[model samples]
Target: MRTDSEIKSDILEELAWQPNVDETEIGVVVEDGTVMLTGVLDDYRKKVAAEDAVKNVRGVKALVGDIQVKYGANYQKTDLEISKAIVKAFEWNTAVPEDEISVEVRDGWVNLSGEVDWAYQKDAAKRVAENIIGVKWINNAITIKQSIQPADVKEQINKAFLRSADIEANAITVEATEGLVKLFGTVHSIAEKKAAEDAAYLSPGVHIVINELEVID
Candidate 1:
């Protein structure tokens, strides 16, 4: 375990290392391993980078990014304009299916709701929304449409884990029902745990993945 002061110093250094983020504008507070970040960022992407940088530091528990996104004068857009632009962008994006998603904008925050056949489509919708000017934040409420049978879902997940040289396949367990997959067991780190969860999601017909994999350093 690391002292609170040590953890704070490491987080500050990490934030400074991120070229996209302005560390001076961000404030860090630590108490009992929980980190709370309060500040203002020029871009939403920079806000996300700060969170990721904090997560990369060990001995950090929960993270709360209460940072605000400060929009410039040139980036201002009306709610109606944002709505129309997002809808048009979705139509132009090949990865996202047309008319499969609905866009709602309020106070510069974009709310996306709809169903898509693949995870990539859901991700694509958010990606396009994030790059748009004047978008303060985004709420991706997209769902996946899966029609794959539950049979062999477990075996396929196991096989994927086995195929990956970085994963310990035997240490993980898979359970599937209809369109949902549940993962149980332990992983060496957060990266390995995410890898296992990604494998579960990659399996066809897995609309929901319940990851109960514990991280053991």
Candidate 2:
């Protein structure tokens, strides 16, 4: 196992490598493979980028992000303006169902709520909100509609894992209870672990994915 200091060093390097993240503004603390990030950023995207970078590090078992997004005076906008922008963004994005989702902005934080047919649509709505300027953070409460029974959810996810070269389908076991899916097994890296969870979310009726896959790197 890598030491905490080593994990911190890799996280710092990863943050520096990401174009959207400012390494100097972020402070990284690592203990027992868990990382806590603290900083203030001008854009919410940078904060998200920082978290993603940290997660990509090999030794990171968990992450706690406390980054604050504070816009400059010139970049500040009223809540109404932010909401309008998000709505417009959703409308323009083909993947997001603009009519089905509701947007509420408070002090630059956006709260999205509604139901969509697919997990991809729900994710697309959040992605649209993230790109809008002055969006400090996003609470994606959008849910996926159960268009079909989840009786075959586990089978479908297992097939998806088999189709992907990144995943070791035989090594991972999938469990489904209604719309909730759980993954248990071992993966070679953090990226593979994430891939398994993403595959689980793509199943027709899956609403939640509990990724308990251990990284054995």
Candidate 3:
């Protein structure tokens, strides 16, 4: 067992090893084994890595990441460029509905506000914003709407199979809404299950593909 201050110091020291993030930029507070991380990271990956590092540490009961991402002023990007990236994020990501989402950038911070049908889409939108060169932090204020029925989920799964080459479209069952495609039924192997998921991810409006297909022994 360690004191809160001791644990916080240890967490700060651990974050120093992460690339693209300086310890000076990181602030840690440990309250009864719950670690709260605060600081601005240059990229979202570094932020994620920082959180993961804290989780892997011994005696961490839970973690709260409040890492702020701030893009370098050295990187120059126009408002149009930021806007375009926001739109492209929606177009390329099947999970996010472009019509429902909105993006705004100010002094390197990206703010996203929208209503998505699932939690994953909100996550995806934030991820897209975090990937941009000048995005320092993302303020995601998106809401999750109602989900579709199980039958609708099956339809999405079938559509995913139909889009694939190897999988038998007729044999697979799908349940979908808000970009999460759940596949039910037997497949040849784990590889087939993965293949089905990959296909569904590439589908026009898919955010996540749940590979629920069981392996038949």
Cand. 2 TM to true fold:
0.94
Which has the greatest lDDT?
A: 2
Evaluate model 1: give its lDDT: 0.82
RMSD values for the candidates in order, in angstroms, are 2.7, 1.4, 9.8
Model 3 regions more than 4 Å off = 5-31, 34-41, 61-70, 148-217
Task: State the displacement of the C-alpha of residue 117, model 3, in Å, after optimal TM-score superposition.
Answer: 2.2
Candidate 1: tens digits of C-alpha lDDT, residues 1-217? 5777988998999999999888999999998767899998778788878888887776675577799997888878899988888888888999988588999899988899988887667878898888777788999898887767787778888999999986899999888998888888877644577678777777766788888877554
lDDT of each: 0.82, 0.87, 0.69
lDDT of 1 at 74: 82
Quick one: best TM-score, which candidate? 2
Per-residue lDDT over 75-148 for candidate 2, one digit per residue giving the tens place of the 0 to 100 score:
89999999999998888899998999999999898999998878888888988888888999899998876656
Lowest-scoring 10 consecutive residues by lDDT in candidate 1?
A: 186-195
- Per-residue lDDT value at 35 in model 1: 89
Task: Rank the candidate models, highest TM-score first.
Answer: 2, 1, 3
Off by over 4 Å in 2: none
For residues 51-106, write the lDDT of model 3, one tens digit per residue: 76775555565578898765566766776687687788789888678889988877
Compare candidates 2 and 3 on lDDT and give the better one: 2
Name the better of 1 and 3 by TM-score: 1
Q: Is candidate 1 or candidate 2 better by TM-score?
A: 2
Could you tell me which 10 consecutive residues in candidate 2 have the lowest summed lDDT?
A: 143-152
